[model samples]
Target chain A: MPSPARSALAHIAFSDLVVLLRGIFERHGTSAEVAAVLATNCASAQRDGAHSHGVFRMPGYVSTLASGWVDGRAVPVVEDVASGYVRVDARNGFAQPALAAARGLLLEKARSAGIAVLAIHNSHHFAALWPDVEPFAEEGLIALSVVNSMTCVVPHGARRPLFGTNPIAFAAPCAASAPIVFDMATSAMAHGDVQIAARAGETLPPGMGVDSQGLATQDPNAILNGGALLPFGGHKGSALSMMVELLAAALTGGNFSFEFDWDQHPGAKTPWTGQLIIVIDPRKSGGESFARRAQTLVAHMHEVGLSRMPGERRYREREHSALHGVAIAEQELAQLRAMTGD
Target chain B: MPSPARSALAHIAFSDLVVLLRGIFERHGTSAEVAAVLATNCASAQRDGAHSHGVFRMPGYVSTLASGWVDGRAVPVVEDVASGYVRVDARNGFAQPALAAARGLLLEKARSAGIAVLAIHNSHHFAALWPDVEPFAEEGLIALSVVNSMTCVVPHGARRPLFGTNPIAFAAPCAASAPIVFDMATSAMAHGDVQIAARAGETLPPGMGVDSQGLATQDPNAILNGGALLPFGGHKGSALSMMVELLAAALTGGNFSFEFDWDQHPGAKTPWTGQLIIVIDPRKSGGESFARRAQTLVAHMHEVGLSRMPGERRYREREHSALHGVAIAEQELAQLRAMTGD
Candidate 1:
């Protein structure tokens, strides 16, 4: 039904996409190496069909850098406190390089001690979290990471917004196939969706948000005006948000969703978030049979349906896109090219 | 208009309940020390108003012993293999004593290493998980635990049951007040609720379960007849279940939900389940200001709502029951008294 060469259905070369992103970041004062890492990650997301976090978000990052809200040239500093604990101060910069630098040391510690924790503070993480966790899983390790964001979502039941759409990402290594990874926001709906619904004058699904009086409402306009987003699955999702606040913000001595100051974070910048990541070597915990056993479990899920595993669809998208290149909408491509001043 | 003492409002002294439970466990071959730990945990659950996991589940444990499903007299053996890793071979026994023995050592490891992982296998975990995590939080440590159970919940989009309701518990300690704890199952509805609904001829919520043909249905009768329960929040909850299975069961060399052998378990017995508990010293991660910071977060939540915190109501119940006593239904009390052959 659609031609690959058509403007509406064009597939951009993954390398070209990464290069364009890298050039933009480099122009904004990020080191070439760091820009490459960040750009590669963004490109990979687009390749894997996570367009929301991929090329679509570049304009946000550009505006953040233009407003001088984040220090684009800043490099992270690492601190190894204890045997299994490591801390990285992103120094009010991007989270990509800091997370990258911490990963190798974390893997070494987990291999020897069976588990290791990495706490990244003063970081602005705009990218999807799975890229950060999937690397560990690919290296035969289990990884979990959660990060706090600017206050955009509400807790289970409260009057005001005090929590973030704090997302959690987890990955497990498989012996016979690709690693299984899933990343999800704790909010019932992302703010962008609520905004679009409001602009379209469409009623939202119940439980997506609340009104100014903290009463549940299906009106997106009310949610946009003064209300807040609800947590997914009611109370369970709220508890998870609390856990994320503690683990990512409090534990790292970073900004909680409610505590982030507008003075320190100007414009529409990524908040100075904190991420806590745990990497574990399954060989020590699960014994030598861990990988084989994981494969069996993965196969069982696949036996039933097209999508049972958490990130199966993502992986499938990745496989096809790797060979065919990433799909880019014509309008989106024009916007991306406009950013490059082409 | 509630009476202090009525047939439906019978109260039992917490001490008396613990003593009775201790006697029953001892009669079934558990050592006094292990019985004391188990009984204290069970009694606390009742006092905290978690009736489902409290005295209500004692018959399940008793039946486990009668069926030789667990070795009541078994003492857990802890093997400290790595710096930050500890494995407890529960030796096919109750999880209470095994967890009790592992707690102190875990604290020491976490204090020194900043984080520690405890993988427990061949254990029957039937009680509330918060008791285990709360102790760590009380000691100024952060704790997270997840456990897998017999297959009862289906993965998202699957017709057959493939995962457990698999509960996850997390706790954070505060400086000025009680610790905050939250534990939840990943199912939209517990299997027990479905069975009760079916027997009572009540319909269920739309997304709670599926019928024999795997179509979403509200009919409880259809669910009971070769149907399965759904995960909470659809795929997100299912991902949590998958995470639990990997962290708790697969990582511990125990059974995945589908792999749980019913042939080895009979009657109202608890099956051999695995639990994975992680303990981290916030002092190492967050520095000395951790507790105060945590208290501020907790206070902020309480400042808005009556009970936004997950275990706030439970804590209130505990304090009331401690001052007075646990209120138990007369019919339920008679059943417990009968179990004790009083």
Candidate 2:
């Protein structure tokens, strides 16, 4: 067998990758605007070594678009709801475009009110959630976001799957370093990671999921096929998952994780649900600068013998990508190029 | 060994318990208003069977006050910072009174602006977090809160303790039932629970903590004596704990868990940190009543074989308490009575 690390590799400039992905998205039925937003998001993920949400998701996005399960060209309708709230109807399109359409107004409200919330519904979210919040932190604001996906996780103490692998993402600015950011799935293992492991014919760690018989198993294939994932951290993680359902779906007037049915669209691969983003302007906080205080906390974390911060690896990957280009498998790059009619 | 379950139990009316606790607080140091707020909070915890934060915490409160580590008579100063922000300087007092002082304004802002945040600093929080949020849910709003405690938990991948047993609590209204509520310590175990286990001469589940030598151990006494707890769910829980420190302490301009040193006042059991509460008015949402949507989700959860929901146990205990009075160990009740000079 070929050594995986020594396999043929392709490296592309981040912008070139974004342009290539944009071509693929536009060719796959998305509007140029939607393509631009999604391509950048996907490219950024790839550049930061977030493979599951990078080019790995392109086929899923394409298939869903081809199946007509999502309206790639639908325009988002932004609502200026209140002093501190903005709502968006994604019109059956992807969530990124909805956020892009409402981002300016959301920022304005957050600045003026000290805090603001954006509610996007009737949308499909199939990307990493960190992207939704990180930019706010870059702008010296704190941001938190939650998105509920299709049900594949069992609520704690439940006999079967009833909740999505709901995820939460948070970002905060720091003084002399990258913004602190983390995006975590409430499930013991993210569905995409499980898929990756199954594709690689790898076994999983114990307690990640159960087989169809509801017995514990370490086989990734079992978890992916007729089995279910468990919530991370037991009941606490389950409760956070439930909270995600409430905030993203119930509060945003979108379909619950289990409410959407796509069996009729056989190629559909996206969950039609909702997303919530909250932005807070730290200038309104008391005493010292929030970023400086965050830096101090990070310093203490290092002092306590921590070798890495939660999102530090991503930052390192980002820097490496800046110097050496975004890495990809040569075979996958060829497939992507072919999809764009190269 | 004696059967703990068969221990003699004492029952006291919830209101009576509040009055008793209030007298104790007032007699110790607090003003009537502060006493009223804390007494009710403490009594409610006992009524809901949250023993870790109920009567068991009163001695710590008294000792902290008597040692002059906290100003029980200090008046919290509430500031209307912005359309969606409220700030409270707790004046080195308890967080509950600060929250009480700003809550009315916070609610008005949340209703008017759609969402609002309250930042309380220079405060000590030594109570169950759920009580801080549950009332907001009962008032038809969504609430989430975080508070940082004294350092005792080791961040994931860190060799020593640096983070507190920081906790996050959330509450949301549900139709046809009590609100959904949860209060979770990001730590593998709450410090109070470890203390309780140590007092009972019991061992803890594995992965809960490390001894002073930084080796994993199940002995609760070791965890309480110069040892440290671990974050729940490993890295994910550690990230949440870090986020708690940023939100509750950094953003509020309060001391980080490791920043405060209470050695001068030897009996100081409280962490003089900060707290943050975010409230949202669901009326601003696009949904068919948010509460009704939540109810639909809960129904589906039950259909999927979930036998109980988060916070259901607390509600059940509360119902029992209402019917038969709040249950407490007979010995503990005697101690409480003596403390009140009754």
Candidate 3:
């Protein structure tokens, strides 16, 4: 089964794509500020080839906004809680705007105190997590973030879904290369990827999920309908998911993955949870340049026969997009155009 | 093959075991302060039924000390790097004493700033990581720690071994339960567990490691001899191992797992690397007690049919040991007594 040729795809400049996405978001009920932040995030994901969180999510966003489940125009309230802590109440809005509102204070604290933490609650986080942390690495800092999604993953040794496909994202500066970055879903598979698979009528690998009866199944539809995904690496990943729930939800004073019920608001797709981000200034470390040391690690990784670093593929995709416009299937591009009412 | 009956094992009071182990450490040339910390740490592991890192590690500690690879009496030098960061130069000594020396200041900073980080360099870490973090949770703080060990793991997609069996341990408070705690190696299994299995002449599960020729094998001895372990969950765990190296070693001005060579000193068993610990004061959270939220999460997990939490078994073992005594094989107890010259 050969894929469509590159010539069959539509290509658009990154800026143009962002504009289009922004228009769609603004038209759908989000404030201009939120539309700007979300547009850039989704555009970046698309440019970097993270299609699971790219424009494919636009429909979900539109539907969620229409459902009145989320306050698309809500302004975030940021508090300087402590010398090293910043708290944000997203006012039932998206997490990105909350993070954007607190970014300056978080950066200030990290610079002055050597470390800082941002806790965003009452937020809907539906996009990729890496975008929240990678920028800090670009600023010569280390960042780690976690966000709990809607419950669809079963904890290890548990019979039902209690935990979300909670994801952990990390980024660190490197001297001679792009920042080291990785975003991993603690679940065996991301829910978005599962949806994609179901859409394409593809089967997943074994150990990924089980059916409603708790029998192992590889059918993406079954897993999406009533079954649940498993955590990666068994109990270790499950523990990490539990940690995410504590840090992102409990510590942030937000609803847990299973706490929010959107039954009345049909078409709601975003998880109304919380997020936590920790940033550290590597300049305050006792070591040689943190970035230089990271470069050394990269060199050693290559020497050991590693062909790519964790975020290398994304970087490559980004560069390709920069050189020759962002690639998208023609049909998907048409859908985006329809969404924009342009 | 059935395991030995509990009645066949010897039991000693926790304090008595600590005294015995302390004597062995001091007799092997450690300072009394170092001996006290190491003994309590080891004894706690034994009391918790974590035999892999319990009295079983005493021989390694003594041998490393005898080889003059690590200092036994060097005083740690702590630097108040920032309002939220503390750095410790361990002077080539054991990490526990360094941590003990700075724990108070770290706690104070975390309390003041809502979060703090402690970075210890030039330290030898050879014990279970859980003990390093569980105490922080006991005090109602959340703690996360990572330490990179000697290289024994092949990074995913790499041809050869480059990363250590880096481990991440986390602890958080729960309202009505013992603090939630878990320590896990990024590798398929902890190196200590592999050594214990090899000594017991037991085979490991598949995918644990490769033989000297890089062929998959279940023989634990092969992994201990010239082979290497694989990262758990493939690339995701490998990325975490890399993150541990960056955080624990690179960020602390300490040697990476593969950077230190102990060939000049025979009997060196500990990794001369660094350790990173991040502690957060959950009291600063905007939530209705963080511990209470964690308890709710635990309740939900149980409702989902979770049989036990991550560290429940360890807590149970500790309770049993408190009621009875710390169980140890008679042969091992005799060896410990012999090492103490008692």
Query: Model 3: which docking level applies?
Result: high
Task: Report clash pairs, candidate 3.
Answer: none
TM-score of each: 0.93, 0.98, 0.98
* DockQ of candidate 3 relative to the true structure: 0.87
1 versus 2: better lDDT goes to: 2
What's the i-RMS for candidate 2 in angstroms?
A: 0.7
lDDT of 1 by residue, B1-72 (tens): 011113476788999989988887887667898789889999898788776577767777788787777888
Q: Weakest 10 consecutive residues, lDDT, candidate 2 chain B? A: B1-10
Residue B206 CA displacement from its true place in model 2, Å:
0.8
Q: Which candidate has the top score in DockQ?
A: 2
The reply for model 2, stretches above 4 Å from the true place, is A1-6, B1-6
Query: What value does the lDDT take at residue A240 in candidate 2?
Result: 96
Model 1 CA deviation exceeding 4 Å by range? A1-7, A191-205, A211-226, A263-266, A286-288, A304-308, B1-7, B191-206, B211-227, B286-288, B303-306
Chain B, model 1, TM-score against the native? 0.90
Worst 10 residues of 3 chain B by lDDT: B1-10
Tell me the DockQ of each model, to 2 decimals.
0.62, 0.90, 0.87
Model 1: how far is A184 from its true place, Å?
Answer: 0.5
